[model samples]
Target: MKGVVILGESECSVKDFPDPVPDVGEVRVKMMATGICGSDLHLYHMDKQQAKKRGERIPGHEPCGIVDAVGNGVKKVKEGNRVTIGHWLGCGYCDQCAAGNIMWCEERRGYGGAIDGSHADYVIANERNCVLMPDSMSFIDGAFIACPGGTAYSSMKKLDVRIGDTVAVFGLGPVGLSGVILAKAMGGKVIGVDIIKERTELAKKLGADAVVNAKEDDPVKVIRDFTGGKGTPLAFEASGSAKGRTDIVSSLCRGGKAVFVGAGSSENVINPGQLIGSQLTLMGSFVIPLWMTWEMVDFISTQDITFEGAVTHRFSIDKASEAYRIFDEGKTGKVVFEWS
Candidate 1:
C-alpha cells in the first residue's frame, strides 16, 4: 500500500506501507477521492506537539469511495457499495452516538486526524461511520460532502437566514464559498468578502450578489452599502481571522445573528456594551453531527445544486506532496485526490 505521511514541519511524503485489512465490523474502502481541508494543512505544518501525536496516521478525512472488502460482522455495506466515510468514529451504542452526536463521544476518534485515513490505497472504517451513496452522486462531490459541504450545511441551518434576507459571508475560502452557495440556494442576497481576488471572483461566480476585496476597503462598509446602507441581518465568519470576526459583528444589523463556522485557537476581543446595545447574537458551530451528516448526504443526492463545481483542483495520489503544496499555498478551492 502507499500512503502520505508527515515528514516534519511543513513537510510530507508518500511512502510505501502495509495494506490495511478490515477488522471485525469494519470495511475496507478503496480510496476514490479524498478532499484536502484546512486541518490537513495544520497537520502538514506539524508543530512539535502535533508532530508527536500524529504518529503514523495517514492524512485525509473527506473520503468517498467503493467498498473493496468487509470484515466479520459487517453487513450494512457489501463489496460493491459506493460510500462516503463520516469524519467521526465513535462507539455506536453510546448515548451520544444514538443522538447522532458522535463528536461528543468519550471514545471519540476521527479519520485523517488521530487515525489512519483514506489518503492511501485503502482505509479501515467501522460500518457505522460509512454512508452509502446513491449512484447519482459523483465521487468528488461525495468527498466534499464529508466535510466542507456538511460543515456549511450545518452552519447555515444554525443561522437560519430567511428568504430575501441580506447575508454577508466573511472569507472566500472553500467553506466560505460553500456558505455563499447555500445562502443563495436558500434565496438570501449574499455578499462575500475575502482579501484574495481569486476567491472574491469565485464567490461571485458561485452565487454571491456582491464580492468585497477586504484588503482594499472596509468590508463592513461595503456590505452595508450593498444592503442599502443597512448591515446584513445575518453574517457567517468562515475566515477564522480575528479582524474578520470583529468586522462581521460590526457588519450586522441590530438584533442580527452571526455564525462563526471557522476553526481557530486565538482569543477574540468583543465589547459587551456593543453586543448588549445591539442585542446581537453570536453562535459558534463546530462539525456536523454524524446523524445530521447522514441525512445531509441523502439530501445532497436529491438536490439539483452543483456542489461538485466547488472542486477547483484534482491530483493523483502519486503526486501527494504536490497536492499538499498547492493547497498549502492557499490559492485554490476544494482540492481532491483522484485514484486511477
Candidate 2:
C-alpha cells in the first residue's frame, strides 16, 4: 500500500507501507476518492520537528471508496460495497457513540489526525463508521459529504434556513461554498464574503446571490444594505479568522441566528453586548454526526444537489505534494485525489 505523509513545510510524499487489514468489527476500504481539507493544511504547514511527531500517520479524513475486505465481526458492510467512512472512531459503548456523535466520545480517535487516515490505497475503519453511498452519488461527492459538505449541512440544520431568508456566509472556502450551495437549494438568498476575488467569484458561480470582497468593503455594512438595513436573518462563519468570526455576528439581523463551523484562530472576537442588544442565537457546529451523515446522503439525493461544481482540482495520490501546494494557496474551490 502507498500512503501520503506530510514532510513539513508544505512537502508531502507517497510512501509504501504494509497493507492495512481489518480487525473485529472493522472494514478495509480501497480508496476511490479523498479530499484535501482545510484542516489538513495545518499539518502540511507544520515545522520540521512538529511534522516528525506525526511519524507514519497518513493525513486525510474525507474518504470514499469500495469495501475491499471485512473483519470477522463485521456484518452490515460486505466486500464490494460502496461507502464513505466517517472520520471519527470512538468507543462503541459510550452514549455519544450510540447517538452517532463519535467526535464527542471521550475516547474518540479521528482518522488523519489521531490515527492513520485514508490518504492511501487502503484505509481501515470501523463498520459502524462506514455510510453506504447511493448508486447515483459519485465517489467524489461522497468524499465531500465526509467532511466539508457535511459540516455545512450540519450548520444549515442548526440555522434551519427558511425560504426567502437571507443567508450571509463569511469565507468562501470549500465549507463556505458548500454553505452557499446548500442554502440556495434550501431557498435562502445567499451572500458570500471573502477577501480573495477568486473565491468570491467561485461563490457566485455556485449560486450565491451576492458576494463581498472584504478587503474592499465592510462585510457587515454590505450585508446590512443588501438586506435593506435589516442585515441577514442567518449567517455562517467558515473563515476561521478573527475578523470573519466578528463580522458574522455583526452581520446578522436582530433575533437572527448564526453558526460557526471553521476552526483555526484563537482571538477573542465576540462582543457580549451586541449579543444582548440583538438577542441573537449564536451556535458552534463541528462535523456531522454519523447518523446525520446518512441523512445528508439522503438529503442530497432527494434534493438533486450536485457537489461536483464545488470541486476545482483533482490529482492522483502520487501527486500529493502538488495537490497540497495548490490547496494551500487557498484560491481554489475543492482539491481531491481520485483513483481509477
TM-score between candidate 1 and the true structure: 0.95
Segments in model 2 whose C-alpha atoms lie over 4 Å from true places: none
lDDT of 2 by residue, 72-145 (tens): 98989999999988999999889999999999999999999999998999999999899998888899889989
CA lDDT, every prediction? 0.85, 0.93
- What's each prediction's clash count? 0, 0
Residue clash pairs of candidate 1: none
Best by lDDT: 2
lDDT of 1: 0.85
Instruction: Give model 2's TM-score versus the native structure.
Output: 0.98
